[model samples]
Target: MAEVTYYTEEGLAKLREELQYLKTEGRTKIANAIAEARDKGDLSENAEYDAAKEAQGLHEAKIAKLETVLSTARIIDESNLDTSKVLALSIVKIKNVKNGAVMTYQLVSETEADFKSGKISVKSPIAQGLLGLKVGDIATVSVPAGEMNLEILEISR
Candidate 1:
């Protein structure tokens, strides 16, 4: 069975957009390149043809990868997500037990993770540790920096 991947609405939209582009403009560009290469020389002796074929191979590989990704996608409903505990699509506020540093992060899909916006992938160590934790609950996570304890303060969205 194909594994199901959870994604937010925005993340799904982005994937759909990418798939559309690959099917349309991306394929067209690759086809054009192949055609140009074919026109330039003897089929077996042409480096341009070889390069174009390689590019086409790479392009199709990317398309197939995207297809697999889209096939497993399951978009999460933000409105139904509970705020009482950490979960996918939840914005959580946590305080570091050792350093007293506070931070907020929205647990999202890998596609939706944007550090600039404080969004983290649910698969990430910190998010994995925070999952199922409620306010006043403490979670321990290990990173390259070492293991740290974080206290959940709030959950929303």
Candidate 2:
């Protein structure tokens, strides 16, 4: 069985929209490419036809993957979440123990995680170390550089 994934409503909507596009406009485009390639000449020696078929296969595979994701995706209810400790969708403010630098990040599902937007994947090393931690708790996380300590300053929805 596929692992169940948690997502915000916005994230799930975006996935649904992408799946719809892949099934509609995306499928139409691939079909047109296949038809145009087929019209070019004999199938046995047509590189364009082969490429189009390959593209179609890849596209179908993507559609299947998206379908599976949608099937297992569940939207989390922020209102019911506990704010006393870090959890998925919780916005956490943390301070570097060694440098005193502060950073805030929202722990989100992998698909919704965007570093530029201050959202980090819950599966990320830092997030993993911070999970279930409360304000004033220190988390020791391992990264590519080395291990660092981060102090949780605040937690919010």
Candidate 3:
């Protein structure tokens, strides 16, 4: 069974839009490429045809994977989330215990995680450690660089 992933309404809409594009314009482009390559020469010795076929296979695979993801996707209601502790979609402000560096991040699904936007994946080590922590709670996170301690300063929906 595929694990159900929770996404914000915006995230889910983005996924659906991508799927629609892949099914329509994306597929049409791939078909055109294949047709153009086929028209060039004999299939047996045509590298362009081979490459086009390979690209089509990969594109189809992506579409299949995305379909599976959508099948198990669920939109999370931000307003109903408990703000007492850290959870998915929670905007959290934390301070690094050693350096006193302050940072804020929102825990989101993998598809919606964008470091530039201060959104981190729930599966990330830092986010995993922060889960279930409340305001003023300390979290010890094990990261690729080393172990670090962080204090949760605030949590919000």
Which candidate ranks first by TM-score, i.e. highest?
3
Please estimate how well model 1 matches the true structure, expressed as its whole-model Cα lDDT: 0.92
Q: Give the TM-score of candidate 2.
A: 0.97
For model 2, what is the C-alpha lDDT against the true structure?
A: 0.97
Candidate 1 on 77-107: residue-level lDDT in tens? 7787777889998999999999999999999
Across 20-124, the per-residue lDDT of candidate 2 in tens digits comes to 999999999999999999999999999999999999999999999999999999999999999999999999999999999999999998989999999999999
Residue 62 lDDT in model 2? 99
Scored against the true structure, residue 13 in model 3 reaches a CA lDDT of 96
Model 3 TM-score? 0.98
Q: How do the residues 5-42 of candidate 3 rate in per-residue lDDT, one tens digit apiece?
A: 99999999999999999999999999999999999988
Model 3, residue 157: distance off in Å is 1.0
- Model 2: weakest 10-residue lDDT segment is 3-12
State TM-scores per candidate.
Answer: 0.91, 0.97, 0.98
Q: Which of 1 and 3 is ahead in TM-score?
A: 3
- TM-score order, best first, reads 3, 2, 1
Which candidate achieves the best lDDT against the true structure? Answer: 2
